[model samples]
Target: MSSYPTPTLATARLVLRPLVATDAEALFAVFSDPAVVRYWSAEPWTSVAFAEQAIARALDSYRAQSEVRFGIVLADTGALVGTVNLHHFFAQNRRCEIGYALASGHWGRGYASEALEAAIGYAFQGLDLNRIEADIDPRNGASAAVLERLGFRKEGYMPERWFVHGEMADTVNYGLLRRYWNERP
Candidate 1:
């Protein structure tokens, strides 16, 4: 069985941990909000039931060793604020894809960046990955900014790459290699 390092990751203001069934309600609250889902791949979650199913799938992915999904919690209050994940793991290539989202209420607080930084550190140092990438919608400036701030350089832009919210969207690819991380202070 593939095992992951423990679930708890603590940053100054945030806690990243495995998603639990009880978190479904809180996740639903954030995910079902239309404003939060505007830039996300799926439409607003219709109900808690949907979030429950999503949580189940996330748990399964972890158990199967296919992905690592963490619930982003506010350390001060222990509230479920969002999620971040490392997916599409290519162990042979020592690479993976990173993805994240936060509730509308938590935007601009640097929570996403902190959470991402922690995840990247785990992937590169703890997990021994050589590269990490973020595939973002070209129009999503906020996400692009997060990747850029984390030292991921924009490598390419693929036009008309995905259909999101009924429109074809271009994708900007951002990548960070271990060589770059090793050189950072």
Candidate 2:
């Protein structure tokens, strides 16, 4: 079994923790909303059952040696505000992909950025990753801004890279190396 500790990462206004089965309700609340999933997966969640299944998959990912999923909780209210993950961990390459989403109600508040910063810190300091990447829809200025604010440089644009809503969407790739993080203010 992997020895990764299930620890909570705290930011100024957010708490990042592993997803528990009991989080299904909160996950459903965020994911079932059309706005929240618009730029994420291909389809919006239709029921709480989908959230349950997703939670199950998250649990499985946690059990694996290469992935970590975290639920973003509001520090003040303790509400499940979003989710973030580090996946495709490459031991040989010392790299990983970072993905995140926040509830519609939580958007525009910097919660996603705060949660992502914590995740990045964990990846670099805790996991000793050398590089981190985020793939975002080309039109998602907010997400792009988050990556940029966190010192990720836009590396490329992949045309028709992801299929969403029955149409192929272009994706922008952003990446930050350990040296980049070290040079940040």
Candidate 3:
């Protein structure tokens, strides 16, 4: 059986669910925006084809029992504003990495934090995970703030860990153990 089964998760204003091929256009728009993906580990997606392939890869990740990437849908309009993810599942260690990217237009609206809270709750409760880690570029203060608010503590840092946008950047690692996680259903 797959360790990660995509489930419908709901919050006050958003629904976290599996991405489908039909969501390609909307997802592409979110990913194609440079501002949205500036701090992302990967470069900005440039085509709808990439979004389609990404959805396929997400399913493959679940099939392999390694990860889950859920599209964050607005509860009222059902518009896909972003994605919340738990990846690099380490079953033996009972750990995983959590991440997200929201459409630029949705920034400062509390969407990412709300969606991530629900996703992390799923990791700790639904999946029985022991720890969740987040790696962010040290310069991305906004993301750092979100991680901090979610009760993740800075665990470490690696200098020049990633080469992005033609430059090297340091990475800050934050972590939260199930015992330390504060959010609840």
Name the candidate that leads on lDDT: 3
| 20-91 per-residue lDDT for model 3 (tens digits) | 878999999999999987877678887789999988998787677668789999999999999988988888
State each model's CA lDDT, in order.
0.86, 0.86, 0.89
Model 1, 1-185: lDDT tens digits are: 23445267899999999999999999998889887776667889988999999899898987776888889999999999999998888878889898888999889999999999888888888788899988888778888898888889999999988877898878888999988877767
In model 2, the worst 10-residue window by lDDT is 1-10
**For residue 59, what is the lDDT in candidate 2?**
79
TM-score of each: 0.94, 0.95, 0.94
What's the C-alpha lDDT at position 182 in model 3?
A: 52
Give per-residue CA lDDT, model 2, range 14-102, as digits (tens).
89998988899999999888888788745888889998998888878767644778999998998897899888777778888998889
Off by over 4 Å in 3: 183-185
User: What is the lDDT, from 0 to 100, of the residue 63 in candidate 1?
Assistant: 77
Q: Cα lDDT for residue 93, model 1?
A: 85
Ranking by lDDT: 3, 1, 2
Total clashes in model 3, counting residue pairs 3 or more apart in sequence or in different chains = 0
